[model samples]
Target chain A: MIQVKNVTKKYGNFKAVDDISFEVKDGEVVGFLGPNGAGKSTTMNMITGYIDPTQGQIIVNGVDVGKRPRKAKKQIGYMPESVPLYEELTVKEFVRYMAELKLVKHKDLKEETNKLIEEVGLKEVENKLIRNLSRGYKQRVSLAGALIGNPDVIILDEPTVGLDPKQITEIRDLIKKLGKNHTVILSSHILSEVSQICEKVVIINKGKIVAIDTPSNLEEKTKSKNTILVTVEDPNNKMESIKDKLKEADEIKLVKDNKDGTKQYAIVSDTNVDLRKKLFDILPKEQIIIFELKKDESTLEDAFISLIDDSKETLKDNSQTTVEEQEEKNLEKNNKTKESKNKQKEKNKKGSKKEDKK
Target chain B: MWAVLKKELKSYFLSPIGYICIGIFLLIFSIFFYLTAIQSASIDLGNLYYNTAMYGLMLIIPILTMRLFAEERKNGTEQLLLTSPRSVTGIVLGKFFAATTVVLITLIISLMYFAILMYFGTPNLVPTLIMMFGFLLLSMAAISIGMFASSITENQIVAAVITAAVLILPWFLPNINESLAALDLMNYYSKFPAGLLSATEVVGLVSFAVMFILFTVIVLKRRKAVK
Candidate 1:
């Protein structure tokens, strides 16, 4: 179980993640969907205890991350965004080292290391140095590092960012398999992948969560009209009058004129209406040969774009009011500390030295 | 702590850095061995270690400690270390001891010169061993300083330069002010090389190492909020 309660991360005056809260139930796979700089990685880092939240609490598996970092971290296995690994060490050695760092038992270290190496499909390159491996293999090595000790909560930040299609599917399958026994929180830009592997999604925009629900629910909410596409050989120009003939059809739009002398038309109708059967029966009677007939479905991508646009408009209106209030608060806080860090304005830059001097 | 220490030690040997550092120390040791012991026929082993501690350490300590935390930060491996179920103090000590152990290995190899000194005549074993022990303390203090420098930056070159500056700046402090002469760590080591055990020097070196080690841990802990 993971609970992020009102988590906020501030680098100087910039709020990387602003007042975001969410929860992942045990054995559930939650996907974090967001545009770049949306604080997806920052939230995962806080949950893993990698970076501290400015004003919030992250409890992982019942242990507060800030209060008991070691205990909470022990419950989590984090594969960072950049896929960091010891370039000098081989795959097996790196996994063994991670096992040791994770406080895996001395006796079980070898067996655990071997199992993870095989699980991530790095057996052939187990003895090769990590620097010598390809990006996909390096990614797998990082996953193996995270999986060591069989941590209860697996937090993978952009796990499939850079990979071939085959490799992506393999990793997606691996994550789905992991989701069966362990609670997995993964972030990705791939909406279809999220819909496939994740049971629920938390979509964030500009450091705030715009929507949170199952993929189907979000798609359903954004899906306002039902449209069916029909490709036909209507050389008689009879497609335009078909909307008038079919009383159920609201709009008939000529989608495309194929070079093969066929026309595709989209028939938009009222919600909860199926026009495929009506078109199949009526097109043949009108001497219109049907080439293809299918419903136009609204996918997660459409849901994501519409939600992002909605959030943008809301932000534009709120910016005038909220920016002022936040700046006022930030000014008072900066005056108290006399230290506004000039570093880490870039996204995902880890570790800071400004506070170190103080 | 032991895990980081062991991994760091293995990393040194895996990349030829361990051999490079040992080689540099041995090269410096051989020069001093020839200068003080072979040419002048000085039976005192203290002068050789003292000379090496004065010169050989500045060059070797940076190489041993520059990559300790800097490379980890640069390569993003610091995430793995900091996010693990380990305290900041343990991680710092682990790297500190790892660098100190590299110097220790070179010192153990320096015993070959000591074995050669035994061929000519029996130099007092007690003072030589004490001098060797004091050299370890001085190296520990220097390693801590370099480790502290490494923790403050992600660039290995910057960390090395910072460490070299910190180590070299003290040598000239006494020239600027008579009171500042006490800041020179070599002054504290004067008695150790002369076959004498000094409590004040032991305390000074240990405190120096402790202060920097604590600084490293505090730096890492504070970075959690800002990073």
Candidate 2:
């Protein structure tokens, strides 16, 4: 379990991770979903105690990471991004060393190291120098390093970034296996991977958390309408009149015209309403041929993009309002200054006229 | 800490750096052996060790210590090391002793030169050993400085350059002031060459090693906050 409270990391004036707080429950597979430079790696680094947070407290397994890094770090198994490894070491040696560093008892160190090597599927290449292994194997070696002590929490930063498709699936399965026991927190820009592998998704953008929920919940929350795309052959040109029969449908518009004399129309309705059955029955009675009718489903990818875009739009609106407010103040100040200058000019004219009369 | 020590020692032999450091140290020692010991026709191994410690260590220690931390930082393996539960002092000492072990191996091999001296004529074993002990102490002090230099940079070349400068610049200190000669690492070897184990020399060399080892640990610990 990990609790990050008001954690912020700043480099000079740039806040890499800005006042972000999140928690990973025991045995929860949490996905840190973000675009590039979204502070995912920085957050992971802070959680693992690899880098100190500029301001915050990260508690791991009830121990504050800053105050007792050694005890807190003992609970975390971190595989950093890019699969950093000791190229000079064999896979077995690396894991053994990691086991020892984690303060594993000398008695169990050997058995644990070999078990981890087998778990990560590096048994065949266990004796190969890490430098000679493939990228995917190197990643496994790094994973074995993290899994050496069988820590309660596993933190992986973009674990499947550069792997082949086959390797990606293998690694994802390995992570899912890891999640059954350890609290797994992995960051990735790949939406499908997160959706398939993680139970809870935390979307971060621009050093801020945009949304956090179950993947399906996020998809459902971002679904604004139930859209049904119906392709039909309306020889009688009755498609336009079909709207009159369906009262629940909010809007219907011709989407595409097929050269084969079939037209595709999109019907939109309120969320949670299904218009497919009505359209299926009504079109036949109206002498229209229904070729295709299916509802367009929203996925986690759409949810992710929409959430990130919405946050960015809101940020733009906030800055625009501040600029407009500042402009309004400046205009008011200019008007007051102009009015005072006019009064002073009038006073000077009145003095000149009085002097002329004298 | 033993984990890191074992890996560091293993890596030394696994890579060419270990062989290169030992090869160059022995090469320099052999050259000095012929020039100072055989040419001077003297059985005293003191001058031979003094010259080797002065010149040979400047080359070998940088090669031995430059990659200790610099390579890890560059390859991003420092993330693995720093995130581990091991203390910074432990990692520093692990690397320090590992590099020292390599120097110890080369020094042990240099005993063959002393063996050769015995075949030709009688050599004073006690003074020669005191010189070797002084040589080991001086090398430890220099290696610690090199290790500190490596921790401050990711570039191994820059680390080596900084380490070499640290070792070489002290030799020039006496040119600036007479009192500064006490700070020269080579000055600590003077008592050993005369067959004496002066407390001042031993304590000075040890404290110097301890000071830099402590500095290396501090640099690594501070980097976690700033990195």
Candidate 3:
């Protein structure tokens, strides 16, 4: 288990990571998701004992990383961002050196080096110097070094950033294989990769965490029920004024114009309104034929973007907060009361369904 | 510590820097041997070690130590060494000993000059051995300073320049003040070439080496916090 408590890394006056706290349970695969310069690498470095946090305590496994760095570091295998390795050493020699650095027993050193080489599929280049290896091979050599002692936690920073699609798949598969046995924390700007591999994702923006939950749950959070996308073929272009007939619909946006005389528009309405049925009833009478229509389903990518934009909006609000702290508090209170009233209405709807069943 | 030492030595030989340092030392040693022995009609090999330690070290020690830490920093391999489950002292000492091994090899190889001197008159064996031992101590002390120079910068050329300036500055300092002669590494070496192994010189050289090694370790440890 890894617990980061109130961690804040300040560089001069800039706070690179601000009071961000999260936990990775034993054997869990967690991802640090953020845009560029989002402090993901900084957090990984702190966990590996490579750098000290300005203020905070990190407990890795059971040892405090700040107090007992070596003890905590021994349990972690860190493949750093740059894939640093001795260019002069052969793959086997490098892995053996890493094993020795990890204080692997003399009896098992030789066997362990060979095992990691074959494990990462570096057996072909075992005798080749790291200088002569390709990027993919070098990445595998770094992974081999990190896996030598079978550390309990393996932290990889941007493992697949500069790889081809084929190499990306290979390395991702390797990480997945390691995830079954080791607690893995990987940071990537690629959203689909995290959604595919990580059990829990910590989305970060501007040094602050925006959300921490399962990827599917984040996708669900951004899924809007009131938005429906429709592909329509309108001869008289009456789709523009269709909102006048459907009073419940709030806005109709022309999303795209197909080259084949069909156009796609998104219909927006209240959260509780089913806008698709109303659009179906009103479009034909207005001389518009609906070709295709479906509800909008946000993927993990949308959730990541929306969450990031949400944080950006809140930061803009925070600038005026110093002058009107009380006004903002009251506004937030009013919003919370409105949210509670909506929740009460939802509960009443569920109760009415139960009565119908009775 | 053993792993780092072995890897450093392996890296040194795998690159040309180790051979280059030894080659430069041997070249300087041979030139001095000709000047102090053959041309002067003398068999005193002690003077050759002294001359080589004085002139050849400024060239050789910087080459050996310039890339010790600087290249690692530039290439990002310092991250590997710093994050390893080892003490900062151990890594510094590992690199220190590795560079010292190259110097030791050059000293051992210089016995060829002694063999040639044996064909002439018998060089006094006690003074010659003491000079060789003193030369090793002086080189170790200089190596620590050179290593410290390497740790302070990431550019290898800058490290080499700083190391050369540090070593060459002390030679000319005594012109300003007589007490400044103490800063000259060779001032403590005035006795070793004479046939006596002075206790003060031995302590001076070892203490200098220990202090600089500690400085290198401290600089590396402090970088983790401030980096």
Candidate 4:
């Protein structure tokens, strides 16, 4: 349960997070998706009360982070972007200290510390100092620190960065498990990770929120046309002419040519139109062998890129479409024409004076 | 506050800084022990603690306090500490007491000199204890200054230098202006060596320590905004 209302963070004249507002329901796993330096970490820090927001308010479980930071912070377990940890401390000692900082009861501290150490799979290395641990283990230690007191909300900034694939999967699985009971907010540039693990995705770009939706909804919203990829062996070179038979197909473009003489074509149609049946009936009659046919389903990666690009386009358009900007362009053009005309008149007058002197 | 205090205390011993501070204090105190008490054949332990607090603390205080906040900020561990539910006052006080405890441990070991003095000659126990208490206060005041220096910067070297400058400069202030002698911590220790429990010196040293401790806390609290 988190509510960020019109929160903005400004550094000098630059706004790191610009009027961005989003909420996470209880027990929801929300993914903060953005490119590097897209204000994701800044937003996470504001939510955790690690840094004060330049403007607006962040409420954690009904407590304002700015007003009652301690009470609000008590409900949050934050693993910062850098995975800040006490390198000199042993794994168990670090977890125990975190438990104590979270004010865990002395009676339950040891048991809770051990449970978290095992949960993050650092039991064998529990006694080992954190400085000697590998990066993955260090990350797990940081996570254990966050999870020490079993806080209701867990905020991890780029949880799986720099980890190997296996370690990434392990961490992702751990986060997914965390999502079952706790409200989790994780920021990452990896779209597939967000799509696979998060229930809702908030895409931010250039200090602004581009879009916020479920993973599937974002993917589906970005797909404007139904696109199908068809690979076929066209002995008679009838692939281009097949578009005549499938009238529902809006455009047929060659995508690639295979070494086996089969050509791949992408057939795009208007929404609610199915070109597969018509192509299936027409291709064989036209002396083309159908090899592969499947719809081109867009992934969250495509959705993210399109959303970011669309926001960039809108920003550009906003600057270009203003009436004052149009008027300024017209004035510039008029000034250039007037300057040329004056130059021509001056040249004519100089020529006439030379003629008169001769 | 207790949680932060315990962890900070544990961290002091876990790192080499704790052992190094203690070892260096003892080494200097022993050297002073010989020169001040043993060689002079005097039972006054005041000069022993006096020299230790003067020369030994110049090095020990920086070593103990330079890493208090500088190392945490440098290593990014400040994020973990600041994000927790603990207040800046609690964190600063926890570290303050931890460094003070290390000096306390060294002071306890320095009592062996008092034991030896008791064996060979009669030493005034009241004056010795009074000086030791005054020495603790002086060290606490110096530690608070060092901790304040550490909180303002992320560079340990810079923090150490600032702390050393803060402690070393006040000694030279009285040389420049006789009236500025009150600013000197050693100036406040004048009466304690003679077993006179002057309330002015006690309150003065404590208030000085409190002033710097509060400064450190304010520095940390304000960092939350700019950081």
Look at candidate 1 and give me any clashing residue pairs: none
The better candidate by DockQ, 1 or 3, is 1
Kindly report, for each predicted structure in the order presented, the TM-score of its chain A compared with the true chain A. Answer: 0.88, 0.85, 0.82, 0.88
Which residues of candidate 3, in runs, are more than 4 Å off?
A235-248, A271-290, A316-358
Better of 1 and 4 by TM-score: 1
lDDT against the true structure, each candidate: 0.91, 0.92, 0.90, 0.90
User: Model 4, stretches more than 4 Å misplaced?
Assistant: A316-358
**Better structure of 1 and 3 per lDDT:** 1
Considering TM-score, which of the candidate structures 1 and 3 is the better prediction for this target?
Answer: 1
> Comparing candidate 3 with candidate 4, which one achieves the higher TM-score?
4
Instruction: Write one digit per residue (lDDT tens) for candidate 2, span A309-351.
Output: 9988987997699789889999999999999999999999999
Each model's TM-score, in the order given? 0.92, 0.91, 0.89, 0.92
How high is the lDDT of residue A338 in model 2?
A: 100
Error of 3 at A112 (Å): 1.6
- The sequence of per-residue lDDT tens digits that candidate 3 reaches over residues B136-169 is 9999999999999999999999999999998899
Give every collision pair in model 2: none
- Most TM-score-accurate candidate: 1
Q: TM-score chain B for all models.
A: 0.98, 0.97, 0.98, 0.97
Q: What is candidate 4's lDDT per residue for A91-137, written digit by digit as tens?
A: 98899999989878899998999888888999999999999999999
**Candidate 2: segments with Cα more than 4 A from true spot:** A235-241, A253-263, A317-358
Instruction: Rate residue A355 of model 4 by lDDT.
Output: 100
Cα miss at B117, model 3 (Å)?
A: 1.8
